[model samples]
Structure formats: structure tokens, C-alpha cells
Target: MSSHSHDPHILCPHCDLLVTLPTLKYGQKANCPRCKSTLTMRWQEPRRRPVGYALSALFMLILANMFSFVNMNVKGLTSEITLIQIPKVLVADNYASMASLFMVVVQLIPAFCMLAIIMLCLPVRLPGRWNIRIAWILFHLKAWCMVEIFLAGVLVSFVKLIAYGEVGIGTSFIPYVLFCLLQVRAFQCTDRLWLWQQVSPAPAIHQPLKVGQSGLSQGLRSCECCMAILPVKQQVCSRCGSKGHARKKHSLQWTMALLVTSVMLYIPANLLPIMITQALGTKFTSTIMAGVVLLWGEGSYPIAMVIFIASIMVPSLKMLAIAWLCWDAKSSKKVDRERLHVVYEMVEFVGRWSMIDVFVIAVLSALVRMGQLMSIYPDIGALLFALVVILTMFAANTFDPRLIWDRSGTFENKEKFDDGQ
Candidate 1:
């Protein structure tokens, strides 16, 4: 670890420790001594790796859209769905909001982020302002682009359709899968601090903040987007131009509103049918719990367990956890802030998977059209379920994790923060 007497100082986002950040050689990473969160890391061939991967991702994304995604054959009737059609189905069904959300997560956001990475990599020609804009955009967009998770849901839906007829993996499936991997790798290759250094070469480094004080009394505040330390009065980061804050304003109110909205939507998300399947004029509608029960009865123990956890257990538990955190907002050092922080991380990590049922419905609705022989359409509950997932996601995001450590006085002083003295 670098020492404040010699190296740059940064506040750890996870634990709020003001520690000296170590500069690393290629392939080396620095972790926060206090909380074990990775501080910064340098990659071997950092310049080429992300650029190569971004180009590859773009290629794979093109291929993913160019060819058919999947083909289903029932009797002499065959139905094929392309990657582009996933969002189109929702739009055709008058679910414009869901369509837009699906498009952004699976398609638009990934493309934009990868392109942004590419632009950021070529910082020599781009203006510093545009570089910051692109990097900042990538920072926020990466969380919502969930091609990998969507692929898992698609695979599960594909398996469920095998009993109906022959399901043929299309030319795009492999590329799309590979694209997801490449895109993820490309993102991992991104080093925000390193990128900032590239753009500016000499960023304004700050001394460790005076701690053991409340509010903005301390001179140093960390940028949530880049972890760059800045003067307390600076509204925008010099390095990333991201807005700085001593504390997220109205965090409790925003979280409470989102959490309550999630609870309100959860009822229909479980009670009403999300997917209505019509086979040979026989209609079968399955709610979240009903689907779980049916899957268990059909002996698909693993899938049933997964659906039960992602759809039912995860959302319910997440709301409870958020509510607990909100109710106990101002944590104390006497209490377990570490455990509380871990809970917040876990909630954010598992929040997105709750959309499994929604994605599965989308795939089923698109690929199972048999001209009335068999057809699956997303139901009212599908929209409501999607709302539930979105609300929970917002609930988690709006609830600032830093609030848990605020009253705890986690950052006592620089001397104590250094590897806990």
C-alpha cells in the first residue's frame, strides 16, 4: 500500500476510509486495507485489450442481430425469432416502456458503452470534455446492460420449449453468447483512474481528509463515480466531472418510495399470470407461485428452485432488507456496519436476477407462435412483474450505502484508517 506521506490519497467507496492509493504496475491491483474493496488496478496492454475486446464486442453484437436468434418447429409450421424482435414483440403488444427497457439492457446500452470505451481509448484525438462525457456515460451504463443474465434466462426458456418440438440454435446464438463474454471482459479492462490519468496525465491529487467529523466539515470528499478525492466545495469533479456529495440527498425518502412501490406491485407479480400458453386451444396461465408449483410438480426441481428464489424469495427478502436498513438508517459503531454494508452489497448484487421470470416470458412469447396451434403471450402480470423488478432495482440504487457508515464514524482519522493502524 502507498503511504499518504508519499502517494495520492483517496477515500474508499465501500468503507469510507481515507487511505493512500497505491500505483500499480501492469496486471497489479490495489485493495482497500479497511474493507477489501479493490481500489485500482492496471492491466497488461491496457490500451490494446479493451480496444480489441470492444471491437470484438461490436462485431459479435452485429452478428447477434444479423442472423436468426432461434428457430422453433411444430408440425410443418416453423417460427424463427431474431434478436431485434425481442423488443419489437413488446412494442407490438403496446408495452412500449418494457420494450425500451429490454432494448437498452440487451442491446442499446451495451453498444453505447462499448463504443464509449473505444472512444475513451483513443483519447489523443478526442477533447478532454468528450472523454469525460464518454467515460462517465460508460460508468453508469455498465450496470444496466445485462446480456449475460438475459442469456441465462433465454437458455432456460429454450430448455422448456424442447418438449414442444425441435428447437434449433441459430447462427447468432454463438456470437451473441461470445459477445456477452467479450463485452464483460471489455468492461473489466476499464480502469477509471487510469483512464483519467491518460486524459489529464496529471490529475489534481488531494491529501487525506480530516475525519472524526460529521457532514462536510472534512476537507476531502470522494467522487462516487471515480473515487477521485476532491475539495469539499467542488460541485463537479476535475478528473471525471461527476457530481460530488457529502451524502446523497433524500436517500431515505427515495428508497422508501421505491420500496413501497415494489411492495404494491409484488401482489400482482405473484397472483396474476405472467405467461399465458395456448396449446391446441388449451389455455394455461401461470403466476409466479403457480409456475413454481407447476415446475416442482413436473419434477424440474432445479428450475423450480431457481424460479422460486429469483421471483419470490429474492424480491421479498430484498424489500425486507432495504426496509430494515431504512428503519435503522443511522448506524452506530457499536452495531455491525460491516454486516450492514455486506447486506447492501448483496441486495444490489441479487436485485437484477429477479427479472428472470420477465425475460423467460419474453423469449417464450416470441418463439412459441404456432398460428393458434400453440402460442404464448406475456400477460398483465408480466408488465407488473417487470415493474416489481424495476422498482426493487431503483429501491436499492436510491438507498445510499454510505448512510450506514455515517453515524458509525467509520473514518475516524487518517492514522487509524491506514491498515487499521
Candidate 2:
């Protein structure tokens, strides 16, 4: 083995002193010597954006919920549907179990989780009593926020759904697309790791005392720009060719725009039909809710239940949660942090599976093709429906759980200082 590898004490990046660490794990972190700065040589800290982005995301969410997704016309029957009616149809058709589960995972859970994050991150002082609860909510929301993954699933399902059904794209799809983008931006803005740092009190800064030159030294320095060891000869960073380094500053406007676009899209997305179907020369169109009714009427209770949960319950809950977060942030009211965290976790965990209904449609379309006499074709509604799912997923992804602790603004200042140092 190399001597460097065998040595128990590894040279500090900042100060040249060899320091021993506890057993090193994959994500283990250490501190710098000269400045006592926290360091993660092998691991990288999570990146996040500012609070404005979170608010914008809220707007996009609303747009996504309000639009039509799909429309269908066949023979003498024509119908239009919005995105909300899907799950109800599934549940009414005797698919209650799947519907209920889908509701919690895809819509209700994620919506609440997003709401918890917004509530926590708002620029208001949280009541000490509610801090614990808020922390818990943050923890849970982190796990439940799986909007991106859900979007991928929805897209794949849409491709297949169009194959067997007459599908039409709706107006809501534009906003839905925007919503996804905003969600990504929001996630970028808010980071859980950063939130943890804020919620947890900082450790006392200790200055090392001068000691004999016994292989340990204080006040050692390294190139801040390049992170290279120096022998007191170099003034500029050799690797990066920089004389100094500074912490990166985030662009508030860009992040804000992202959120704003997402919110704007939410409006039309909810208003439009998500799917349109024509069977046996009879044409039918259904929004998320109408689909549930149709399924219930047909005695497909199981399918109706699935649709109800995935399309209705989940999205509605998410809207409420986000609204609550916005309100809490503005009002600075104390919230149940732990509960909110749990809500967020549930949202992320279940968000992706909402595409199960879409998946079923895809499978059916792919396998059941009979040319003009019995062919399934996708319409604008499927596109819009797909957009709603994708946008919501993005919304979940964009929202950051750590905004809760940002009220004090100390974390931001500290980050700036660390970058400068």
C-alpha cells in the first residue's frame, strides 16, 4: 500500500496539518484546518435556490389543476372532460382499493408535502412550539416528492394511450408543460440539506492555539480558488488560474420566472379534458371526474377507484397543501412541522404511480388493435392529461423542503461568508 494511503492522518486541504478521521464512510465529511471551514472533499453539498421560486411554483400548480386535457367525438356522441374527473370514474367502477392508494400516493400526499415546504420556507418566524412539527413535515415531504419520475411515466403511457383511442390535445397542456419546468426550477431553488443546516444550530467556532511545531500547525493556508496545497510561495491558484474565489450567487429572477411560469400553466391544465374515448361507434368524453362516473355506471368500480385517486384526490390535495404553505409563509403562523414533513414524504413516494391508469390504457391500446373497425387513437385530451401529470410531478420536484429555516436569513449570510473565506 502507498504510504499516503496507510497514513492514519490525512493532510488537511486548508491547513497542511495531518488529521485523523473517524471511519470514513461514502458520504463522510470533515473540516478545514486554517479556517475551521466545513469541508466535504469527496461529497458535495446539495445546491438550492431562493424563496421567490417557491412562490412561482405555487402559481403553476393552480394552472395545472384548472384546464381540460382531452375531448372525444364518435358517431353521435361527443364529450369534453377536465383533468380532475379521472380518479372518481375509476373508484366508481369498483377499483376503490387502487383509487384510494393512488390518491394518497400521486395527488394527496405530494400536494400536502409541497404545501408543508412552502409553509416552512415562507419568510416568517416560526413559533418555537411548532418547530419540531415543521421539522418532521420537512423530513417526510423529502421522500414523498417524486414529481419528475411520475412525469416520465405519464409521457410513456400517453404514447401508448393514443394508439387505441381517439385522443385530442387540449389548451391546458401548455401550462402543464410550463409547470414541469417551474417544478424543476423550484427544486433547484430549495434544498433539504441546506434546510437542515439552517434548522440545526451552528457549532461554536473555535480558534486553534499556537503549539510547538510537532507535525501539527495552525494558520496553514491553501489556494482558495484551486483548493491546492501551497508551500507559502504561491499567491494565485495554480489549477484554476484565479487569484481569489467567492461563493456563487443565485439568480433570483430566473428562479422566480421558473416558478411563475409553472403556476401560470396550472390554471389551464386543470380546466381541460384529460382524455376522450369512443367505443363501438359510440363516442364519449370524460374529464377526470366524469371518467369515474362512467366507470361507476359500467360497474368497473375498481378502475373508477384508481382514476379517482390518481386524477382527483391527489391533485386537489396538492393544491390545498401548496395554498396552505403560501398562506403560512405570508402569515408566519406556526404549523405542525412534523406532520407537514410526513405529508411531503407521502406526496413524493406516491406521485410516480399515478400513471398506473395511463399505463393500463397504454397496454390495452398496444395489444388491442383492429384497424379502422376497432382501433384506438390518442387525442388532444391525452396530451393534456399527460401534461397535467408531468407538470404536477415537476411541481413536486421543484419545491424545496428547506425553505422553512430561511426565515432568519442567517444561513444565507453564512453561506456567503463560507464562499468568501
Model 2 lDDT at residue 320: 56
Superposed model 2: Cα runs more than 4 Å off: 1-50, 73-79, 202-421
Question: How well does model 2 score by local distance difference test?
Answer: 0.46
RMSD of 2: 18.7
Error of 2 at 9 (Å): 16
TM-score for candidate 1, residues paired by index: 0.91
Give the range of the ten consecutive residues with the poorest summed lDDT in model 1: 412-421
For each candidate in turn, give its C-alpha RMSD to the true structure in angstroms: 3.5, 18.7
- Per-residue lDDT of candidate 2, residues 237-285 (tens digit): 4333334322112322333343355455545544555444545676555
Over the stretch 1-421, how does candidate 1's per-residue lDDT look in tens digits? 3332323666767666666665566777776654566777778877789999999999999999998999999987999999999888878878777788788888999999989888878746575477777777788777788888789889778667776788888999999999999999998988877776665543465443443343344656767776666677787887777786766778899999999988998987788888888998789888878877877887778888988898899999999999998987853435677787788888989999988888888888888878679998888998998898888898898887767766655454445422221
Model 1 has an lDDT value of 0.79
